[model samples]
Target: MTINPSTLVDLSHKLDSNVQIYPGDPLFSCTPHTTVAKDGYSVHTLTLGSHTGTHIDAPSHFFPDGQTIDQIPLSSLITPLVVVDLTSRELQDRQTITWSDIEGASEHMSPDVALVLRTGWSAFWGTPRYFSHPFLSRDAAAKIFDRGVRVLGVDTLSPDETSYDGVGGEQGFGVHEVILGGGGIIAENLNLGGLMNQNMIALVPLNLEGCDGSPVRAFAWKD
Candidate 1:
């Protein structure tokens, strides 16, 4: 069934000067360039990291010769989605979403679908805990990539562990490399709280030439 436009649920986290971002990355800023009081119109200038809040990471993000953000096709941006809920049942000490969790989520999977992983991390948007939220284990990411999934959207800043290395700090981007290197893109920092049961999603990324990533305004449609 076709979903009504009015029923589209926004799956993007609102971006602002203080939206959670990767540490050491450029801070998001929006300053008034023109005010209605003076110019009869309002305009604001923005400064932000390419991979800022609610953004899509193109293949070029990790692979030097990968596709640029502008090269992402409309077909790739809009697709049927399978929201995989992994956090609702996890224990406090469990942070890595292993392959078993993914297997459980995909028992009735569809082909060529985008998988949106919800970790319940969106609830901590303004806190340090958000940065330390659950991540997809490398083994799990490898399975997803092998399945030919074109896009992986997440409610966390990364699918990779943000604070720890392999033994406690593995700098190698295992998830990013597997997904992007496979010609698959990733959408990060999503507001998936309302999308746990969603079956479709649309990602509209800014068409910036030669860009590696762009903040996207995402939405999910009903079943």
Candidate 2:
């Protein structure tokens, strides 16, 4: 089958020094190692956390012996995508995305398919409001895993509530613990706004050995 590259929808945020990062994480920096004029070639030295920008969290993110970024199968990163767009719901800051809110998607949840929660939070990417994105409840995450969903994606910093200045301090990181502890993979900070009729997706991360996570060049296309 012939597939046009243009038809693929980009689902990753562009990485730069200005990309909003999770609090306490390493800041992204790109410095020129060699300039074309001086060295006859251009090379850049990139410095950033494994989970910087659009990235996938391997099971190792939470479990000490779980699969690492390089251990995950490439085929698992590329699969049919099932999107649950919640932008129309007018989600509030630090709101909990309960199971009932996504119960309708139970039918599509599976190990072979990638489930993406589109909270439309990508719009606040560079501001403090970006950290106030809606998060999935631990019960909801458990339910998703119960359905054999090993891969999950979200258009936010995390599926769990972003804790800031004591806000969301009680919620903890239950969602992350549940998913990652279950040996599942999570793709975070995705740019799902451009997604329309696309079905399949590829979230290819770097093969960083023993790394808990890695940035991915995520994209999607219709079958």
Candidate 3:
């Protein structure tokens, strides 16, 4: 299907040296490899983790033998998008988002569409506050997966709480385990503030063979 460029709303953060980096993850950097003044050409060498910026986590992210980034089918990259707006909930730091907060949006939950949780956390993307954004409860993750929704997206660094000391929260990476273990996908660090109630979005990742994840140029548009 051809998507008109005019209708696209970018859902990805601009990647650069200052791009928000998850704790313990590799920092992003871009250095000039060849300069026009010297090599008669320009080229850049980028250094970043596979999960840097707006990215999709494949099943292999948590499970060793599961499908990898390159193994994901292209047909599954774009789909109907369901945005669950929870900004009004006034969720607090490290707060847990339960099923009750999501039940209202269940009507749109299904296997084909990508379910994105918009917590308005993208506003804090470059600040320390971003790490304290609300997280999904384990039960909530399981329920979402049970509904047959394979693609999960979040505006925060992760669907689960961001661990600072490498020690996990009570729920751990339950959200990742539940979704990816079920052969699902999880898109993180998305800029979803501009998206509408319903639309079509693409979370296409790079074909990085045997990789657990890849940065994606996420975008959405209303049809």
Candidate 4:
């Protein structure tokens, strides 16, 4: 079972109307205007939030002075990644991921790594169950920022908890502010459960100028 470079694994979730979105976010929709039988061409009108499905959150997503998606460096999108499994803890107690969790996972992390938190929450993608789960704590976010992580990703809709009154409510904004303010990007709503081996990830986002964020086609390959 020697994996080679040609082996590609898609780490992104499929975008569709059924996919769950953050509360108050725009719903995904598509309408076909031309079909093979009608105009011998296929055309569709698609609509979705910029952060829909597997997408990158540029600095401007949170910080007004942050860089837009078009300004994201290509080197940051293509890099070595380390996947830390949080499924067991999420399923057992729905506990918030914290700095300690990142510290424990860092024993195997590299200097320039893309940290991915796998909470197995993607299983609830199309259901109401995905929105109410525990989220990453502000402490965890600060620790990640302190560690100089280039990119942060999670299986959940957001790293911050949904309850506006929760502990991370205001602090969570600080987290986004810290990371994006520091030129780091956040990748949300990812589907990385199927990827096993640690390898290189390719994150390609639409080149939309001045846009806060954009949808992305994220993938991984190993050797």
Measured by TM-score, the strongest candidate is 2
Worst 10 residues of 1 by lDDT: 163-172
What is residue 19's positional error in candidate 3, in angstroms?
1.1
Per-residue lDDT of model 3, residues 30-94, tens digit only: 99999999999999999999999999999999999999999999777799889999988888888
TM-score of each: 0.92, 0.97, 0.96, 0.88
lDDT of 4 by residue, 1-223 (tens): 3546566788888877677776677889998989989999999999988888888899999888889999988888888878878766645324577777667876655448888888888777777667765567777777777767869877777776654324235444555666787888888888876777757777889999898888888887784
Estimate the TM-score for candidate 4: 0.88
Give per-residue CA lDDT, model 2, range 1-223, as digits (tens): 3456777889999998799889889999999999999999999999999999999999999899999999999989889899998989999998899999999999999988999999989898888999999999999999999999989999999999888777774668798888899888999999987899888989999889899999999999988
TM-score quality measure for candidate 2:
0.97
Alpha-carbon lDDT, every model: 0.82, 0.92, 0.91, 0.76
Clashing pairs in 4: none
Clashing residue pairs found in predicted model 2: none
Which segments of candidate 1 are over 4 A away from where they belong?
Answer: 91-94, 107-111, 164-168
Q: What is every candidate's alpha-carbon RMSD to the true fold?
A: 2.3, 1.1, 1.4, 3.0
